[model samples]
Target: MSFFAGNISYNTKLDFKTISNPAAFYLTNLEADLDKNKIVILDNSHAFAFKVPGDIFKTVKLPKDNWLSFSYSLNFRWDRSNTYWHSNFFLYLKRANRFFPVIEPILKKNGVPDDMKYLCVAESGFTHAVSPAGASGFWQFMKGTAENYGLKINEEVDERYHIQKSTEAACRYLKDLYKSYGSWALVAAAYNMGQGGLDKQLKVQKVNNYYDLMLNDETARYVFRILAIKIIFEHPRQYGFNFLPRQLYTRIPVDEIKVDTTITDLAGFALDMGINYKILRIFNPWIRQNQLTVNQDQPVILSVPKEGYREMEKLSGAFEYTLSADTTL
Candidate 1:
């Protein structure tokens, strides 16, 4: 392993020509190459010490209820591997800056713990992903669950894609889970596996603590994933993610425009806003189709660029893809 310009790279060549279990071989390949200090490095050069670092609990700001067992020490080493220690983690750090500001206040106001926000990182890394089981959005709320949490999901609109609404719905779910399990760690585990599944395990094992229960691999790693995100993002530079403010995605402001009437053309609406259909959709993702039809007593909610908040009407002509030279916002 060599260090260059704050980046670490692992330079190991393996000829797996004679290996049958190559998948298993690759995961354990680096274990044999650790230095005397037990420093393990991955292809991305993210380095971690396997020999349980000093004051593990304090390093991670672990809750008093959580036990920093030997298993967790090992988990932390794995979490700090290239996957979490390198560019993947760096990108998450950047994206978190964009999404967390919007999520934090809601979580706080809804009486959920701040650490729970890391579940967003574990579920989707602040990106849009569709799970094979049909979970969607940054929160990965299942269709039924999203509906239960007040997120709209239908042929016309999927509020799961709406950042603010989805995060609010996620807060609702987390707070609900917290009511059942007073521990954040337990809540994290239950979030991965359903509440019923987790409750069964708790009863069978006679253990109320998340750290003590035996669980499936995904559920076992769920809280650890949240903890890993919390630790790495808390001290990102220490993990080699020295991202600049400009490198992060911008959290642009938007103004909501209420519409009760049906609109046949989204492109024309975008043109009227001095933008394009793409930009309009990017701002208001819940408007899923080219046309929006409001319910009898419901109004269609649309958010548009809030920058400058200029002239009431007058800014329409031949719509150019580029912004006008003198136009501000």
Candidate 2:
């Protein structure tokens, strides 16, 4: 009796109509209902999961946002062949509540699109801890590029891991890329491949749109992946993800202290602050060394979590104790 139960006859074969029927999309995939309150994951490897609401199938639209839809076709796609292809997007959506709220003010302050916040996911899965061909930080800037964008890269510290500083740097970079390409989609493509590379490809292929260009696999799929993320994130219920507000990542309270001078031992510093060294590193991951040495007076802000989550907040802080270049030396 589900309105969604119909088979689409495509060519010679019948395509099971998961998307065509709204009621079927909701009822048949009983396990995927948005209100289920279960942490369902698109992939086991990427550590991406969402807590579904118990009554998601019964509900039509997201609670507050009407701009978002419940249409299955617009909402979900089967990417069983490639998982990470959507991890960049899924992880971003799961973490949007925490990191995104913080990113909005920064983007607004710098005059960028609210949508551009997804660039972090496109760049490095909102993980300040990442290493891809020497790119670092959530924005995924190389050492040279990070320096060009006014981020300090050094042994004692790398500001690329600093969310605010790195986001500011990303805003500047994105704005410039926008000025050059004049399209946000193209600008996103250019982020993966350099502007010069994009220019060469465009000229060679005689195509300006991101989808048309023949380029490296990573760059080719980049824009689509972002779009996919946007679609899934904007319509989680449609894609079979459901979650209550409390189930998603929440903002943590923190206290910031400025250290203009270097500390001989970060471990000792944490003890003095009445917290463990492990906790210290959790908040200020840019701290690469056990001791911070300030050769020439430079100030760095350290964020210490209020309590109870640093040891347990594994997913919230994306990268912990991952290898990264120390530009401070």
lDDT of each: 0.66, 0.63
Estimate the overall C-alpha local distance difference test score of candidate 2. Answer: 0.63
- Could you tell me how far off, in angstroms, the CA of residue 34 lies in candidate 1 after the best superposition? 32
Candidate 2 clash total? 14
lDDT tens per residue, model 1, 1-329: 11233444333334444434211222233334333334434456343433333555654545456456635644654555434345566567666656777888888988888888888888987766778887877899999999998988766578887888998998889889989998887888888998999999999999888877889978877776666566555544344443333455556666878888877788798888766776776666666677767775888678776755323342232111232122122
Which digits, one per residue and each the tens of the lDDT, describe model 2 over residues 49-83? 33232443453333233223222222232252024
The number of the candidate with the highest TM-score is 1
Question: Which residue pairs in model 1 clash with each other?
Answer: 8-45
- lDDT comparing candidate 1 with the true structure: 0.66
Off by over 4 Å in 2: 1-91, 295-297, 307-329
